[model samples]
Target: MPFLGLQRQLGIDLDSWLLRQSAAQPHGKAGACHAFEREWVECGHGLGQTRARRECQPEYEDFMECMHRTKLAARLKKILDQRDKMIKEGKYTPPDYQKSQEEPRP
Candidate 1:
C-alpha cells in the first residue's frame, strides 16, 4: 500500500512486478529449457527422495544438458564454420535484402 501511488503512476501492478522479478532469475518462466525442466520436475514430484533421484536421472540429465547448451553450442559452431567456408569459396549467395541494398532502388 505504501508504493500504491508510485505503482499507479508507473502503470506497474503487483503481477507485472512479480513477472519482471521472475524473468530476472536464471530459470524463470522465459527459460529456454522449460520443457526439459518440466519433465524433470514432473518425474520427481510426489516421490521419495531416493526414488526420485533414481527415476528422474534421465530427465535431470536432459534438463542439465539443455541448460548448459553444450550440444547447441557445438552445433552452432559447426554451422557457422560451414557458412564461413561457403562464403569464402563464393558458394554462398547474399540474401535478397543484401543484394537490394547493394543496388540502387528503381
Candidate 2:
C-alpha cells in the first residue's frame, strides 16, 4: 500500500476504535470520575463520613419532602373525589356561579 494511504487507514481505524470505546462506556460504570471518587471517599474515613453525611442529608430531606407531597396530593385528590360524590348525591351544593359584572382590569 502507498505510505499516505496506509497512514490514513490506521488513523481512521484508531479514531473509530476510540469513538466506539467512548460510546460503549462498558455497563455499570459510574458516569463521572469525580463523583465516583467522592463516593469511594465517603465509604472510608471519619472526614469522608462527615462530608458524606452533610451531602446526603439534603438528599434524604428532599426524598422525604417528595413522599410527603405525594401523600398530601393523594389525600387531596381523595377528598375532592368524595366532595364530587357528595355533590352528585345532593348532600353538597357548590357555590352559585357569580357572573362578574365586568372583567377586572389587568
Candidate 3:
C-alpha cells in the first residue's frame, strides 16, 4: 500500500472535517478532558498505543464520535452523487419521493 493511504487509514489525515478548537478551553475546570487525551495529544513514538490516565474516557469518546461523523459524511456525499446521476438518467426512482435529493449538509 502507498504511504499516504496508510496515514489516512491510521486517522493521521489532517483533512478531517471536524476541526475541534480548544485553547485553554479543552481543559475543563477539572482538566479531565485534557488529562484523558494526553496520551494521544502528547504522543511522539506510540500514539494510541500508550496507556492514558484512567479518567480520560470522554476524550476517547469524542475522538471516536468525530471519526464516525467524518466517515458518515464522506460516504453520504459519494452515494448522493451516484443517486443524482441515476435520477438524471432515469435509472432509480422511489414512490412518492421528490424528483431529486437535497445536497448533503457539509
lDDT of 3 by residue, 1-106 (tens): 1254786677664422222323334335433334434434443223334454344455666655454567678899999899889978999885666645787899
All candidates: TM-score: 0.42, 0.32, 0.33
**lDDT: which candidate is best?**
1
Error of 2 at 60 (Å): 4.2
Model 1: how far residue 51 lies from native, Å: 8.4
What do the candidate models score in CA lDDT, each in turn? 0.71, 0.53, 0.53
lDDT tens digits, residues 1-106, model 1?
2254787788765533433222445544555766677677667767868999999999989987877888889999999899889989999976877654656589
Candidate number that wins on lDDT, 1 or 2 = 1
For candidate 3, which ten residues in a row score worst on lDDT?
A: 15-24
- Report how far residue 24 has shifted in candidate 1, in Å: 10
Q: Model 2 clash tally?
A: 0
Error of 3 at 100 (Å): 7.3
Model 1 C-alpha RMSD vs. true structure (Å) is 11.0
Write one digit per residue (lDDT tens) for candidate 2, span 82-101: 98899889998877564335
Q: Which stretches of candidate 1 lie over 4 Å from their true place?
A: 1-35, 41-57, 96-106
Candidate 1 is scored at a TM of: 0.42
